[model samples]
Target: MAGFIALLPLLASANAAAAEPGPLPAGWVAAWSAAAQAVPPAQDAPSFNRAPDTAGRTVRQVIYPTLSGASARIRLSNVFGNAPVTLRSLTLGLAGRESEVVPGTLKPLTFGGKTEVTIPAGSAVWSDAVAVPVQAGRPLALSFVAPTNAIATTWHKLASQVSYVSGPGDFSSDTQGAAFRGHITSYVWLDGLAVDAPGASAVVAIGDSITDGMRSTLNANRRWPDRFAALVSSSPAGARTAVVNVGISGNRLLNDSPCYGKALKTRFSADALDQPGVRDVIMLIGVNDINFGWMPPHSGLDCDVPHVRVQAADLIAGYQQMITSAHQRHLRIFGATVTPASLPADREAIRTEVNTWIRTSHAFDGVIDFDAALRDPGTPTRLLPRYDSGDHVHPSDAGYQRMAEAAFEVWSAPRAR
Candidate 1:
């Protein structure tokens, strides 16, 4: 994920609320999701040019759902664009090697009974439900074609999943991926995949890059949330539970970034609460807010613009706000202690103070001590060597598994319900 923000004068506010989702459809749950961020404009930075051009191109993306259903729907976003985007065609099917779709599984998708859709700028829409069998842990491919000159201005910048783009034409119905000549590592336009699973509920894992699975193996689905979903499915009582991730890399609890999307405090409602069938949330944030203030500022794109230093009380207040909001929605919220990230004495003190409250205050319905699960016994302030993802900040695959285990122990306990 780009750790820096863009230089543009904060164009259109990507944080503007989309139209109210109204009443959620009954018996439907979010199977997968990626928080949407406005693509940084092309400046001198190479990181700003990551968004793929979608004009008249067929983009196929692979997504894995944690629940099964006989019908499904998709959510698309144009929230950061200045122009309307028209999808001339869209299709879904079981995925095969690379970008290929399994034969006989491909089906067309429509919006409001129409074969195409035009999303207005700064808005998003959910497609009409399509009768398609969805399986848990199975990969599904979603392909769409933009017939007009449409650039991907809004997207999940660090999908950690490989998506394919076809040469200039509509290949939404093709069973083969030969037309798909290029590959991208981000998800464009698409933000969510939902399935009609009665009685099934979801757990949203929200936070910063750690939850976003940054530095995890690409296309491997080894994110801690992904591992947690697997554990949920294997347990006898967890068959009906789903987990969706809305973590934006470099996200903060109290502040927003041009590249990292909105602050957790500001975007929680849209990214987590608004998700269909959401019944629980597990949040791990504040580390960035504590560390970003110390990053040296550069000339062009200063992502940490405000760089406001925070204290334990400041972060505690943020946590209180989230806990209240989750309870107001009648959902159980779990707090996660920030994992070890080798830091200076001052920052480490802030992290320790914040984690102490998360552990002792009982502010949340439950607590997941990720810091304890991954920290070195000999060096409590650093991640265990095996857990460190080479960088002291993020976790390796084994480290992510430990995190999932910690969450599963708390989430699966009889009292947690």
Candidate 2:
């Protein structure tokens, strides 16, 4: 009893152990870029949902990347809007699109003064973040109730993205099952962001092959940034980093490619800064520019175009310009070291030069070495044997894991500032 009393005296009281606020780390950043837009129903296609297609159209996945620096303030987009779009009601609930069905559990979202919004031709609107539980593998339903005379665009001729569709071939309207089968009714959504939330930030991940998880696992969603999301969610500190993957395959930083964000200067403001919940920029690109640049029928193709060789100086300038834009918004810019390529001797030489510049440059807020993280310990120039997805150019599922590990390590780590 005396020993217990002595221990009690030594024990620290909860009040006595009142916590102290240490130096605050940088805010968590989000990365979400609007890709497709939906419009009110038109006479030709009044009610649009993904329909069955023989050309193998299906709803692969629906991704909603969150942002940081603002809580409760969320924005949604179909940035690649081809025409007028309309959305009636929004919901965020268990997709139950294919595997399961949980009825009557749809959540509604809102904005300024109306639930129904009409986006003009070639434009988008941000959704006011409706509080909802958004997690991976959970698809969302953006319902449009009685959307009349609406014209919108989904993924069309988009061989790079794996989204569910209603039509055939195009990610547009034809999909695996009847469009009504996955019918989200245009009035409900599963989960939407809370952009108005205080203390939220977002990081836009811009790039080509690497950002898309080209060689990563199928149906596993093991992309590097996805893994980073898990890490951040589980971490006491990483709770702030909202990593968005804006990488489009075959995309170029300076030119419009089949699978890329536009060039460094043009896309900087759109893909990164324009995001609703954004505060930081983490870039992983340039490899495609090196390899695909040498190939024919490129994303930004032009017959008999100049056989110009894009040099390191050009890339450096692009990086400088992108960083400057982010800086203007008080956002931190982190340049990623370019990864290695399995291209011909000449192309490899160009890649080496670009990577060297990324590592050496002191211009970026920080450097994420995906090249160092995914390369073979032995060869140094190729993706690790196990990480290779058959093509020497892309990473295997494991390779994406390695990429995720590398990025998450930094994303989850305490901020340098």
Candidate 3:
């Protein structure tokens, strides 16, 4: 039993490799994704010390999602890191709880057959595929030890899931969670996970906080994308389609946020077009561009953006650029009308204009009317009382479900010939 358990991953890898018969096939579909961004140490950073000098720690991140195949690989990014960082070791396994890996399910991960890997600044590397059968909608854990001090780390601040970090030591193979000394809400080092899904393709949801599931229950997989994933997994498309979320909490369509990284136009290629097996994109952005444009120049969020005022025209042009880029990659793009939000008159006008274009424009391959889905029937500019998450900007779990249903309708529609 012990020997068979240890050989499970190896055998799965051999079977997958034999089926593909060459370099890893292009059929790798993203099962999970968190767009990498630089989180300011002093603002919204996780409780743990995220500075580069914090090293010699073993971290275990639990990922809750299902993969499509028996063989899988992980992608680690240093896109926001200022210097190279060495990962001393890495491993993956089925999770038993918050930080514990199920005994005997843990498997070592390697890059080019080597245990140690140095990820250069502003880039990412995918580990060699391992035979780890992951069930759809299940949880998996990844453990790694950082041997050297890091000066700057690339991470996604709003993981919406709890991850664990341990005291100085290489605990990558530990099956128990007792050694995890602290907890972090954000995901570090990890960015994406892909699996050999044969005919499976993916739809990448590109947007801002609402798409990121800001007010939804944490670690519950209540994001609209998660809801969409559930819908896809049970539909006729279930066996062939997956939904991947690439949203950043404060992301904007026209301008860049310091914490969220580049503007949608600049990061679209990396976050959406470049993902494995991506056949479509559901873009729901622009509220930030409208809301932020109305804020005073001295507002802290204004410092990261240029002083120019953004208008609906500028935002539409940005969407046009994104559409062109997606088309260049032969990926279908679906524009999502921005959801309702209470804003000042000027910003509200811009939102109205942008949403109108998204509905009337023929530029997008298709349009998902998210605005119509969550808006209050009596007061069109505000979210439904039940759907509002209290901020009036984000949505409640009920609202996210509605948004998911709206998107599913468009996604499940018959493709035009």
Candidate 4:
């Protein structure tokens, strides 16, 4: 009787402890990410016309996470905005058709325990972690209401996924989504979504339009990184790996464009190395650096301004710099051969020489032969007929899949930590 009475206090204490909320899971892995770019002027491209002010409107963006977790957080960027932007509210929910969300699954998100957060210009903010069940490959809709004075100047220019915007008020919490009357293909403000996925790490695929899935079917999630994530999920050795795409359309290896974001040499660290729980990098750039120099200057918004010609040696030096940076962070970086872009003889020679060096240099931790995967057997400088997306440069869905397969065959997930 005395022993039983003594154990009661200890048992009650344990039960009390169990009732209290525990800390969020430890490992934070980037489940979805898009490279942010300054909103180009209307003169740069017609798509910029769709870039909304977002003031007093609800912007709901859909993201397909590559990793699953019990809790998650989101990253909002004003990195290129000229002024600070205040958000009124934020919510996350499972996506339904068009702008609607799954009933009863919507959850509010707070920053530092507050409902509102002001992001200074040229910066980003992360929302506090919320207990939301996330599944790999499932789409999550993130909705945020902007203040009346907010002006959106930072966005992922080529989101390749359609997002929604509401009419004149805060519809961030609207599950029916009837108020979401506006549709945009760009992801404004929102850049990244990370989940507390323990034992999982991310691989960031960084490059230009090809890696950006420029011509892939909209809202279909058929990018090479998307396909790579699918492959990782099925492989027993990499079941816990996540793939993130940080490609920007028209991006270059050495030069920044007025329309495209910063050069990969400049943005590589911030976009890929600094990502949460990233362990590997796969880079496939240089095509633009070789081709942009030949584009004729136009009357307005000449994005390919410098037209600085680069040789195989110049491109090789850029790769060496990236390799050094990746090694400094103890990351395994893989070099991806620049895929066929149907270049002329001069540019084709540069591509061929650069690819040969990439395959032979042994400078990167490994190599991914994207060229071999999509190139025509007959005309080596052009894409295979079945793999071309009709735009000799970008790959079709099958080509993206083949690229993913090539990576998978050489991929080795980070060693257990």
Candidate 2 vs candidate 3: which has greater TM-score?
3
Compared with the true structure, model 2 gives a TM-score of 0.71
Q: Across residues 1-417, which tens digit of lDDT does each residue of candidate 2 receive? A: 998887785553421222111112233233334322222223333123331232332222344444332233234444455554455544334345452223654455454445655554444455554555554334443333423343233332222323343432322222223453342212111112333334656667777666766656554567666676666656776565566666655556666532233454566665567654576678887766565556555332232122346777777777888888888888887788877666677877777887888788778887888888878889888878887788877777777778777776765567734
Using lDDT as the yardstick, the better of models 1 and 3 is 1
Q: Which candidate is the best by TM-score?
A: 1
What is the Å distance of residue 74 in model 3 from its true position? 0.5
Clashing pairs in 4: none
lDDT of 4 by residue, 1-417 (tens): 999999999976754443222233459888899999877675555655446757788899999998999989888888888887888678998998889999988999887666777777887877888888999988999998877875677888788899998888888888887899888888888889899987889999999988888999999988998998898889887788889999999999999988788999999998999888999999999999999999987876777877889999999999999999999999989999999989999999999999999999989888899999999999989999999999899999999999999988888445322
Q: Which prediction has the highest lDDT against the true structure?
A: 1
* Candidate with better lDDT, 2 vs 3: 3
Candidate 4 vs. true structure, TM-score: 0.91
lDDT of 1 by residue, 324-357 (tens): 9999999999999998899899999999999999
On residues 296-354, what C-alpha lDDT tens digit does candidate 3 reach at each position? Answer: 66543333455457899999999999999999989899999988898778778888998
The weakest ten consecutive residues by lDDT in model 2 span 183-192
- The root-mean-square deviation over C-alpha atoms between each candidate and the true structure, in angstroms, is 7.9, 15.1, 7.0, 8.7
- Rank by TM-score, descending? 1, 4, 3, 2
What lDDT does candidate 4 reach at residue 411?
A: 88
The number of clashing residue pairs in each candidate reads: 0, 71, 3, 0
